[model samples]
Target chain A: MIEKQINQKAWFMVLPVFLLVAFSAIIPLMTVVNYSVQDTFGNNQFFWVGMDWFRELIHSERFHDAFLRQIMFSGIILSIEIPLGIVIALAMPKEGWGVPVCLISMALPLLIPWNVVGTIWQIFGRVDIGLLGHSLAALGIDYNYTQEPIAAWLTIIAMDVWHWTSLVVLLSYAGLCSIPDAYYQAAKIDGASRLSVFRYIQLPKMQRVLLIAVLLRFMDSFMIYTEPFVITGGGPGNSTTFMSIDLVKMAIGQFDLGPAAAMSLIYFLVILLLCWIFYTIMSNVGEESSNGGV
Target chain B: MTFNWMAWTTPTATFFIVIFCMLVGMTIWEIKCPGGAPRQSILHFETTRGDRLFVSLLGSAYIHIIWLALFASLSLWWAFAIACVYALCVFRWV
Candidate 1:
């Protein structure tokens, strides 16, 4: 029998994390919670409203519309990105000079700042000068993101795919790279089909990374603000107004601190809840796979 | 120390204090009874006490919001009552 040794001094190493979380997350969260129940009319004066903002926000059509749009955007991006990333990862070369080329190219999009990516896409989707818009127009498509709701959505989706799919790609590629050659050699010897290889060998290995990729993509897309803000400013008649963008508009544009704070709380709650659901469901799937092994 | 940066109202302050107390209590409870022996609940997923607590808290938030949305003129004490029942059901079954 082995007696496990515990270190008392090891607790010191964890103090910094708690301190950081307290300052960064807990303090600001407490502030937001304070603001959510209070109304202000400037000069640092505030009055208690007692859940009035949360009540109002729950019934607000604008909030509902923005939330639905956010959900739709997240769903669309996840559906596209996850599969596309896996496919790209599968296609990537295992050896030779192409490996670095593929890895670097896949990484380049992620390296760009979010706002800069937005600006680049905003220009890239212009009807007059930009390549994508011009090419679409030249090909006889009615393509004006500024004018058309559908066009704006299409542009945003394309921009998001171009910018963030690389993250999924890189994660999946790493997952793929982790597989031992012995597994592949055995599969080949066993006369396994490519589809069988993917279904059995590749996918199971990629599960954890894909879970991470899915959660990251879901959260990022759900809280999408900068790109759409830069590109459309939540325009084309509130077509691209995600929850975060709308929250910003409420907080800064209208100076409705209470409602904005309430909205922020709700928005954060929704993200937290959805992420938890994703984690639970995915882990359940993992557990089932492990238990059954079929 | 001084805490003047935020304009804290009683209800809001109580709200945070309650959350903080619940967290501390949960930590103590976890230390006292390790693992909590994850169980497959009515939701058809395995969850420990912490997971159930999170689900309950999140559910209570939605319940309160919905109650406020629907019954604006009514006293909020009833909503709180309903949330308590919801939490009980979660802890008992889920």
Candidate 2:
């Protein structure tokens, strides 16, 4: 075996990333961990609560409901956005000036602040000055998102889809663009139909990007707060109260720091677990496909 | 209940119309030129036009989000200003 040289200087190059992550993620995470195990009252007085907060959170029905809502919201959006994005990506022009124009348009929604998106929808869904609400009302549908749970759910889902599907589209489009012209030429020579070509070639080529898109969408949706908070304020009655919103209501709104911190830890763990599972499964699928081809 | 097409606000209508124009422009552009060649920019990575657009948009979004979070009470115009500068840097380097 050949001897490989290890460079200590490379450590300096990576130190910035490590420092940034520690400051932004690790330190705050540790603070939450510290808070999770201790009960605190005014003036920063604290008592060791041990596992009490976690135990209570795990048993709480409100926590469970919010968790379920978070899960359900992520599920609904991923199912819709992934396929919808793929279809839109397929329809998009693959080259030239069209490439930049299409990409920029798709990315426009993603560039807007989350709260602004919620505010836009909030006004857009108002029965008085809103376009959608007024149109729905004029069509003889008694649509009121504020008062109706189903309507609220629908509106939030629509808003999320509108906000995020572009990410999927952009990812898929990038994946599509990476496919060589030779692949299409080969498909033509094989007399493969459009659908078969897409299924065999395009979908397989897109798997890695699709995996990234899915994981990103999952984590973001799971941690969703600002947009829905602006729109519904977690109610007409707590109908749109997802996990993050609930956690905020507990920690900041109610000053229940211990329980909120515990809940946040659990929430973080769930996202990590799900993302790991997704990564493993998708990567294994990728490996299997390459092996089968060989 | 009667439907009134004119009830749509100018901002909302303008939003959709701009999106429509973009789609139309893209279609016309594709008809004119069929493919993009990847080019090396100031950024080390080779990028196509689409990639550059994506990087700019994503970077701008992060800048805006961070700005909003840091200065919640302040006017957002500064964020827009910074985003414009960020976009320019991305287009130039990335």
Candidate 3:
């Protein structure tokens, strides 16, 4: 048994992050809350209109549609990126000079700024000048992201996958690399098949990183605005208008501050609730699996 | 017509070229001394040099993204400054 020194001075190191979060997150959040329950007109005049904007936003069909679209986009992205990332990670070279080569190349897309990604895709999908557009047209494919809703969705999804799959790959690769060589040597002694080895050893080792990857991907994709906004400007006719774009349009574009503020709160709560649920469930599953494996 | 290389703008070409050079450099470094052994850090899990780079780059991207989302009209220099700080922290701790 050892006695630990409890020093309150340790909290000093944490103070910076706390202060940063307060300024960046809490202050803005409080401002939004203040705006949400109030009405303002012209020269700094304001009136309390408690819950009116919240009621309006909840009853709005536009909010529901955008919310559903956001959900669908995240769902589709996860389904594609997770499996694709894992497969890429598995196929990647595990040793020698190839390891860094593979990792750096895979990470290239992720390092590009989001708006630049949007611009690249936008240019790459142009009908007259873009490579992809030209080739597809030459091949007799009716691919126009600006004209068709399905085309717009597909392009956005593809763009998201291209931009983000590297993140999942890197996380999965880290997880894979963490497994001790002894585990593989034992499996070899048992004459375990490749699939079985992956199933038992690699998959279990990957559980923690995969949880992190999924959560980060989910939150990022759910809040995604820049790329899609730059690409289609929420599309030809609100076909691809996600929640973030819609919120910005309402608040900044239309200056409906009250409604936008209320909507922001609702959106924030939904994401927070969903993330908590995902975290609890995944951690519980991880614990049970480890226990059972032991 | 043969491929028109000029269609690619300066920034786009430069981005890809830089990434290519970095990849080549990393490959040479790895070949000279293959080093991926995980070492203990401030974080609970062991991490290699490559992991540190990933964490730094990813965290910086997040900093920029958050700044862009919150303050769209402003120049990104402030975001870049903040991201630099974030990168330093990730390199030190994560």
Candidate 4:
């Protein structure tokens, strides 16, 4: 075995990335923290309010409902996208002219801006001018996402699936590609059924990537804002108001800076906590896999 | 209902023309200097060619201002052409 030297030079290589992340992420986070503890009465006037906003947010029924809605949305999105992505990945041809075309087509939706995606769906779901709306109306279906709560939920969910399922497919495909052919050959020689092969070989191989996919989808879906906000505007009696939407409403609409800041902190913490849990479980599984190999 | 046939046609035509010219130019360059040409320098910090194109075309203030100007002048075809060029640039160069 060759001994590897620890290279300090790579730290310099990573410096630019660190600086960019700090500018984009850390500074804004610090500003949010600053705003959370201060009471503001417009025109930059602020007074220290120390934990008042936090207490109020915790007690607010609106916050509670928003939180529950957020959880449900995230849960539903994960359950749908992950399995769908996996199946799509599995169904995709491994090698041929079709691969690149399929990959590019799948990736196209993800490349569109979040706001544009919302606009596309909004138009697509419109009963008057939109294709989907016109077809549904022609077929005698009472489908108006703008008015109905269930319609709003279904449209948002479908839009999210269309937008994000490709990520899971791509990640799972990468994981599948990395698995050595020897494993498959051995399984085939053993006369393993397709389901058994998937169960025993494909799934274990995909565990790490699936963990990553789960965590990414969880964080992203949990903090989803632009698409749903543009489409639903958190309307239909606030049935679709996720936490981020609620935060924006408080901060910008109501100008309740303190409460919004507090809620933002809570939101950040929840994501962090969930991410940590995911990381722990994933790492432990990785360790177990490596140890089992030994 | 708001579908404009003329709005789509001009830009689509312009886009294909630009792409055709670029590809033809690159092919000519390759034929004339089979052995070598100066390598294009790229900014190391940028993510991808596509991302850079997106920044230049849609994210840039100038491009947006130009687009708005064209739209205001009712040069909708011109606006569409610019949009097509924007898409083509992103697809080809990033």
Candidate 5:
């Protein structure tokens, strides 16, 4: 066997990336970590409280409520978006003049800015002037997102689904497009049913992209802030205050720096742990499925 | 440039410095020994040196946070001990 080469020069090439990450990410992260442990008066004076902020955060009931709401919202989002996206993708035209039309119409929702989506939904759900709320009122429904907690929850969930389901659809469509003609030919020869084709041919082929879509959707939904903030402002009695919104309220609105910083770190860690679990479970399932439990 | 804007405190500075050292040390080890191939372990997935390190660091952070939450005091040594055990298990079996 030939001896493997080790080039020390590679470190020099990596230096620029290291510096970029250090300045962009590490420095800000370290600043937050620094603030998490220390309390402050005015004039940039800080006293080392040594985990006091962290202690307060973990034990706080507000934190628990936000966390549970976040988890529930993410669960609902994943459940709805994944299946709905797959179905939409399946029904999407694969060839002819309809393909671009379908693709562009589907992509239209995703191209809108997040804040604009929130604003649109906010207006569109107004009982007095907005289309959805006005229509619901005309139907004799007692739907008011501003005052009713259930209505507020439903509206935000609907808004998120409308805003983001396109992403899942696009990814799944791409996955579907990448499936070669031979797979369908093989399935046809075997006299496979539609569901069988989807199960053995489509889904297995789409697993990689679907995994990506699931992870992206899970993380984005878990960290949801802007749309809900713009629409509900965490109002109607804090029913929709996810962790990021709560963290912003603490850090910016209340100016509780230490607790806010601590909360941020904890919040990030929870997401990390959850994403890791999702990644592990999904990967294991995919591996087992593909390898026939080997 | 002064780091005064960072609101630097001694303990937090030391904490960051230690983490920096760990990263550098891991890189050096990878360069010298070069045993960084992905391997399957008890965790039922393939992991490399970097993956184990990431899990270890993340686990240690949660350990410390949990200790603070439960005891209402920073049990540095105990948390460290737990983190070491956790890291060892990850390194060996994950």
Candidate 6:
């Protein structure tokens, strides 16, 4: 039986992290909450404006557009990255020196800062000086991300895929590595084809890691700001303006503190809700699969 | 176009110095209470010595420089595209 005692010892171990996260996260959150309910007049003077900003943000067309765009962007990123990661993981060698090489390569993109990823793509897609843009122009395709909305969207999507697909690959690879050799041997003895083996063995084995990849990618993509903001600045007429970008514009650009604060709270809650849903679904699937195996 | 060597030097130097200090601090702390290496399971592979080293050096360098450059440039999208190619090459070959 598990110990029922009040484990004060574990709290000691966790205290440092708890304190750090509270300082970094909770304090700012409280500040945002305070700002959400109060109006500022530039010189430290404030007035109570309960629910006014919240209502304004909720009714704003700009907010609606950005919110929709954010959802779409997150959805596209998840769909593309998750499947691509699984495929890459499958193609990678199960064992040998190639394993380390592949793993390192896959992890390289995730290591780069979000802004760097944006900058690299921005230069790379330039028509005159940039390699990709120059090459495409040479091929007679007029690909200008700065001037064209479709091209800008494509470039942003491609950039995201390039930067984050590695994460999915690494996670999926880990899931693949954990599958026992005995499973493969059993399948082989039964004369299972490659497709069947992958279907019955690899797919099921990878479910948990895939779940993690999905949830993480979804959350990160939803909150993405730096890369796209740097790359497109929310233009070709707000084509690539995700919610985070709009929030930043509101908070810092316009100094609409109350509305920005409310929006941030709403944004945080949206992410929290999505994360909870993802967790519940994943755990349910895990339980069902385990039960089926048993 | 002329390269901004002066512009580059300060940040790069600062980054290295900070990293060096961090390593020194961590080493001292580890000696006091040697903890087991944390195990993180990935789907297709386990973490190896070479993998960890490569990631630590390359990852930190890329993250720092890219983040800095993003704020420095007038046109960030162009820089982002180039970085993607660089990342792709690093992953594919490095």
Top TM-score hit: 1
Highest DockQ among the candidates is held by which one?
Answer: 5
Clashes of 5: 0
Q: Which lDDT tens digits does candidate 6 get at residues A102-210?
A: 9888888889998999999999999989899999999999999999989998999999999999989998889998999999999999999999988888888888988
The runs of at least 3 residues in candidate 3 whose Cα sits more than 4 Å from the true structure, single-residue gaps closed, are B1-94
Candidate 5 residue-wise lDDT, B1-94, digit = tens: 8988788988888888898899999999888878786899786788898989999999999988878777765457898899999999998888
Which one wins by TM-score: 1 or 2?
1
lDDT tens per residue, model 3, B37-70: 4576674455666666656655565565456456
TM-scores for all candidates?
A: 0.95, 0.74, 0.75, 0.72, 0.95, 0.73
Instruction: Give one digit per residue, the lDDT tens place, for model 1 in A1-294.
Output: 999886679789999999999999988888898999999998888988887898888888999999999999999999999999999999999999999999999999999998999999999999899998899999999999998999999999999999999999999999999999998998999999999999888888888889899999999999888999999999898999989899888899999999999999988898998999899888777777767763
TM-score of chain B of 2: 0.63
For model 4, state the Cα shift of residue A142 in Å: 1.6
Candidate 1 wrong stretches, greater than 4 Å: none
List DockQ for all candidates: 0.74, 0.01, 0.01, 0.01, 0.77, 0.01
Instruction: Please say which candidate is ahead in lDDT: 3 or 4.
Output: 3
Q: What ordering of candidates by TM-score runs from best to worst?
A: 1, 5, 3, 2, 6, 4
Candidate 2 docking band: incorrect
Residue A48, candidate 4: Cα error in Å is: 1.5
Model 6 residue B90 CA deviation in Å = 50
Which of 2 and 6 is ahead in TM-score?
Answer: 2
Q: Compose the digit string of candidate 6's lDDT tens values, residues B1-94.
A: 6422112234334644765685676567656655524333332223333334444445443443344334442444554466556555443444
Alpha-carbon interface RMSD for all candidates, in angstroms: 1.2, 20.0, 18.7, 22.8, 1.2, 19.5
If you assessed candidate 3 against the hidden native complex, which CAPRI class would it receive?
incorrect
Residue A30's lDDT in candidate 3: 63
